[model samples]
Target: MSNPNSLVEGWARRYGRLEARPSNVNPLDEFSGLSRRLRGLRLKEWIGFTLLHPDWYSSLIIQDAHYLASSEIYAYDRAAAALHQHAVTMRSGSMPMPSALFGHRYTAHRGDYSIEYEFDDTDGRHVLAIDIAETATAPAISGELHLDAAHAGRPLSVSSRLPGRRSRMYTHKAIFPAGGVLRVGDREIVYRPERDLAILDEHRSLLPYRTTWLWGTFAMRAEGGVVGANFVDRPEITGEAEESCVWTPTACEPLDDVVFEPAEPADPDAPWRMHSADGRLEVEFTPEGRKEVKRQLGLFAIDYFQMFGTYRGVVRGAEGSYEVQGVHGVCESMRARL
Candidate 1:
């Protein structure tokens, strides 16, 4: 019933202090633009971001892409590292986010990413959504999955799917390194390289099923510090990268012109592959190196589907002519009622 971490609540109270202030920023103006921008592009370029906590019993849903830019930690890292994530372009044009989606995009630089949803009721694209990403680290479990001395966070948590579930809360804190704090909370974790600050958790809600969810962001630093970036939370399990994106330094914005294509899986236990438009990148995430952080609450069997390392392959922005490597991190899993 209550988010154990109380992150959303904390965010509401401290959002102003931690992130930049525009005073009159509107969610609809920021998020809904995704559709109009891509109105001319092929339908294949539309994408959405979402977070799903699935288990056998109760599940929590968080859907956001460009609702608000309240956290500077994200806004800064995302805008700073635009090359790695949204390799194509964050938006198609400038239409604004759909009023239905409950999310926002935050970055120190507004030109790096974009947001948009398909306007199915009247045509060109039948989707509506947004995506947020930065050069930050996601929650992790040390090098190994077991309770190691360096392990942090809630020690890996899991839950299941229960439609219409109430919002669960948790303190958005991480055992961050020196100066790695994003939006000040009880703790901080490094999501960026070196400091590796964890891309701490935030508040989440739900979108209609059959609707996609692509959540989380990632990027890499290259020559002159030009970062290619993208964020996705495709929770539908259908395996689509339309909402998943990656972009370069110039022309980056939210819900504008973002798109991703999942690469074919080579191994049964490896991270899946994905590519941004124009084949600038060939990125894949491997979960084989992760240790399972499991927890069971009610009919839900939740596990932090984590791999100690990550699998990455890029050519230009983040990838370099068919290059490949393993990345270390954890993947989350939750199962709830059918």
Candidate 2:
């Protein structure tokens, strides 16, 4: 492992840069059929205290999922899992988070469900749309939104008061749409990732950093099948560096040696549906949509701090077929000059 912290930082800087991509530059993604490698890259082990509420399984909220984990990529996993725990553990608090306050929110509604997609108004500070997916009850709601990250860390700012919202906030919070189905085995629990998040930074040319870390949920089914599904990243593969991670949980262990190759969006006017390939595990993912979280780098655009989407891919195996679903991610912004 090269473990080049400086190199990784340099690429991070490039990812934020805005420039026209060189004609000869090719992305080494799953669709590209290029194998990515990782030696020593950026910070690896993410240490954080995490939490999850048991009611998450019964909730119809997208944030209320069966698994809660704290990952190192950017500590988003920890933030998410901790919020869940807070929602369940301390339903009412002086200062509270939404997920914690509504650990069992899914139990409140019931109905048949559907998926909706729409883009809200855009601002230089805030750029993104929301993907709303609903399901039958014990109902639950899953809405994916790319809120403003441009000013996420900015100093105190007045937020637009969302209309028709009555929940009081000791502290302000951002939430996507709510309502979806709660599965029978949905358990609200937080954990350290079962598998160490993999980094392809050192080995993969597709990645920009001297190294990058991939974090995701890796699990197995009751039928003795393995399941490894999590988003991966190849920051700085192209100027607007791309990031992606895919898995099959039905296996004994998370699939390894995955790749990302992309094709222009269906309409050639839509987002690209990149293929996440892992031949050794016979798993691949076709992205369904993209959610832009952040777009920066002066007007030319150098950095992209964003998220995208993925769909369950049909895994071809010697014995039979397997279904992988609920995939999402982002590499929003071209010539990411970060």
- lDDT agreement with native, every candidate: 0.28, 0.24
Which 10 successive residues of model 2 have the least lDDT summed? 153-162
TM-score, predicted candidate 2 vs. hidden true structure: 0.28
Q: Give lDDT tens digits, candidate 2, residues 1-338.
A: 12122222322212221121111111111121222222111111111111111122111111211112111111122223311111111111211112211111112111222222221323222211112222231222232222222212111101111112210001111212122222221322231122111111111122222223332222222133233333343322222222222223222222333444444533423333323445433333332222222334253222322222333454444455556554232233333321
lDDT of 2 at 13: 16
Model 2 residue 47 CA deviation (Å) reads 9.5
- Residue 122 of model 1: what lDDT? 24
Q: Pick the candidate with the highest TM-score.
A: 1
Q: Positional deviation of 290 in candidate 2, in angstroms?
A: 3.2
Which tens-of-lDDT digit does each residue in 1-338 have in candidate 1? 22232212322311211111122222122123665243212111112221111110011112222321211111112212211112221332332323222233222224433233222222111221223343354221111001111322221112212123221111121121112122211222232333232222332222222233333344333343223334444342222112223333332222212333334434436445555446665566654332232444354233433222253766454333334454332333333221
RMSD, one per candidate, in order = 18.7, 19.6
- Give lDDT: candidate 1, residue 279: 63
Q: In candidate 1, which residue ranges exceed 4 Å CA deviation?
A: 1-201, 207-217, 226-228, 231-243, 250-271, 276-280, 291-296, 299-304, 315-334
lDDT of 1: 0.28
